[model samples]
Target: MATEITTAPHDGSTDPASPARLCGRLLGRVETRLHDFLAAERELRTRVDARAAAPIDALTALIDSGGKRIRPAFCVAGYLAAGGDPASEDIVAAASALEMLHTCALIHDDVIDASPRRRGLPTVHARHSAEHARNGWEGEPRRYGESVAILAGDLALIYADQMMSEASPSLGAAWAELRSELIIGQFMDVVVAAEFSADVALSRWIAVVKSGRYTIHRPLLIGATLAGRPELEGAFEAYGDALGEAFQLRDDLMDAFGDSDATGKPVGLDIEQHKMTLLMGLAMDRDRRTREFVLGAERDPAEVRRLLDETGVRMDVEAHIDRLVEKGRAAIDAAPLDERWQRELGAMAHQVAYRNS
Candidate 1:
C-alpha cells in the first residue's frame, strides 16, 4: 500500500467530505509528489557526476525556499470542485507540474527583471553570480550566473513537461496552450516595459494575459479538464479571469505599499522597472502628476507611491478589487457545482484578491 499524504491543518472541522478539507488533502499530495520527484532526480544526477547535480540543487532549493503555491491550489480546487476522485494520482501529477512550471517562470523572470532576491533569499542568478565572483571563476560573473540560472529554469520546464506527461493524453491540448500562453505573455510584458507607452488598454491586456489568465484561469481550466468536467469551463473561465485581475492588482498594491519583509522580495520593482502595471495605468489616467511621474526620465518609486495615494488611485484600486471578488463569487454561484464548492471557491477568490503578498 502507498503511504498516505497528510492534509493541511484543519479548522476543527471533523467532516472529511468538506470541500476545503478535500482540497487541502489533494494539495498535500501535490506537495509530496513534488518533493519526491525532485529528490529522485537529484539522486539520479548525483550518481552520474556531483557537478551535474548543481542545477538540480538550485531547482530543489528554490522549490524548498517557499512560494504561495497558488497555481497548485487553484488546480486542486478546480479538480475537487469538478468532482474528481480524491484518490486519483493524475491530479497530483498535474498539480505538481503546474508548480514546476511556476518555478521555472520565477527563475527566468528574476533574470529578466534583475531581481536580487526571492523568498527573502538571494535569487538564483544573484546567488550564482556572487559565487562566480567569489571564486574568481570564468568570464563575466553576471553572464555565468545568468547562464546557470537559465539552464536551471530550462531543467524545471523539462521536468514540468515530464510530470505532465504522466497525466491523461486528453490534457495535451490544454497543456500546450497553457505553456505557449505563458511564453507569449512574458514576451509581451518585456516588450511593453521597454516601450512604457502608458496605454491603459495595452497594460490591461498584459495584466490579463500575463498574470490573470496564467495564474488563475489556466490552472482552473486544467483542473476541470483533469476531472473530465468540460462543462465547468465557462464558469471557471469567468471566475478565474475576474479573480486573476484582482490578484494582479493586489500584487501591484503590495509592491507599492507592502513591506519587503512580508513580501519576501523587493517592493516597488514595478515602478523601478517602469513596467506599465494596471495600477500605474489607472493612476496615469486619473491624475496628471501620476502621469508625469511615470513619463518622466527620473522616475522615483517613492514619489510614484505618494502620487498614487494622493490621487486616491490606491483607494480606487481597492474598490475595484472588491468588485472583482464579487464578480468571481457570482460566477461560481451560477455554476452547477455543489454549494460547498461554490462557497469554498468564493472564499478562495476573496483570499486571492485580498492577499498581502
Candidate 2:
C-alpha cells in the first residue's frame, strides 16, 4: 500500500504542553532566537563603527529574505522526537546555530557560483558589487563584492561556532565533523562541476555528503545527541541517507523544469554551469543523446529538458524518489519513538521529498 502523508494546518494553538504543538512552538522560538542574536550582534558592531557592520547586515538581509529553514527544523524535530525536554533552551541555540551555518554556506556558495540572485533578491555579492560600481570603489567592483561576501560568510561561520559553543560537550565531535564535511563537500562540488564528469557514483557521493548528510542527517543527530538519545543515531542515519537523496532529486527536478517564480531562483542553472547533478547523471546514463549533449561544448537547456521528458528519465526519477521516501519512512517507523513522533517524522519525510521550493 502507498503511504499517505498529510500536513496539518496551523490551528493557532498556544499550549506548548501539547506534543502536537511543542515542535511548532520550539521552531518559533528558534526564529526568535536568531533574530535576537543577530540584532544584538549588529548593535554591537554598529557601536564599534557603523560601517564595520556591513557584513552583519548582509547576513541579516539573507536570513530575512526567506528560506525553508530545513536544517533547523530537522534538528529540532530530532531532538523533540527523541523525548527531549520542551523547556530546554539548548535545542533553540543549536537550531539557531545550524541556521547561521546555513547562512554561511549560502553566502559562500553564491560567490562561488557567481549567482546573481537568491531567494528572489540580489545575492550579497551581486548587491555589494552593484553598490561598489555605483560608488566607484577603488578596486574592481566584482572583486570588491566577492571580498565582502567572503568576509560576511566568515563572520557567519564565527557566529555559528559561538552559538554552538554553549551546547553540550558531546556535540563537539559532531559539530566539527559536520563543518568539515560541508567544506570538503563544497570543494568536491566545485571540482566535479569543473571536470563535468558523468560518473554516477561520484555524483551520488557528492549529493550524499553535501546535501544529504549536511542538511538532514547531521542536524537530526545533533538534536538526538543533545536529547541524550544517541541510540537514535542509527535510525536517523538510515532515514537521513534515504530522504536526503530524495530531497536532492527534487531539487534537481525543480532546477531542471520548475518555474523561476515559484522556485525563487533561476531554473536550468545546473545545466548552464555544467554541474553534474544526480538528475543529469541519471539522464546521461539513460539516454545516449543526453550524454552527448551534456559533454558537448555547446549545451541547450531546452534540448536537455526535452530529452529528459522524452527519455522518461524524469518519470524514473520521480519513481525513485517515491521509493526513497518509503525507505526513509520505514527507518523512522522501526525506531523506538512514540506513535506521535513516528507520525511526525514520517510526515517530515514526505514533506522533504515532495517540497516544491
Rate residue 117 of model 1 by lDDT: 92
Candidate 1 achieves a global lDDT of: 0.86
* Candidate 2: segments with Cα more than 4 A from true spot: 1-20
**Cα error, candidate 1, residue 181 (Å):** 1.2
lDDT of 1 by residue, 1-357 (tens): 111112442245678888767977888788789889988998888897888887888988888887768888888888888889989999999999999999999999999999999988899999999999999986999998999999999999999999999977878987898889889888888888899877888777777877777788888888889999978889988988888889888999998999999888899898999988889988999998889878988998888888899889999999999999999999999999998888888877877787766
lDDT of 2 by residue, 182-288 (tens): 99989988998999989888888888878878988999999999999998989999999899899999999999999888777788998888898989998998899
Clashes of each: 0, 0
lDDT of all predictions: 0.86, 0.87
RMSD values, in order shown: 3.2, 3.5
Off by over 4 Å in 1: 1-12
Every model's TM-score: 0.96, 0.95
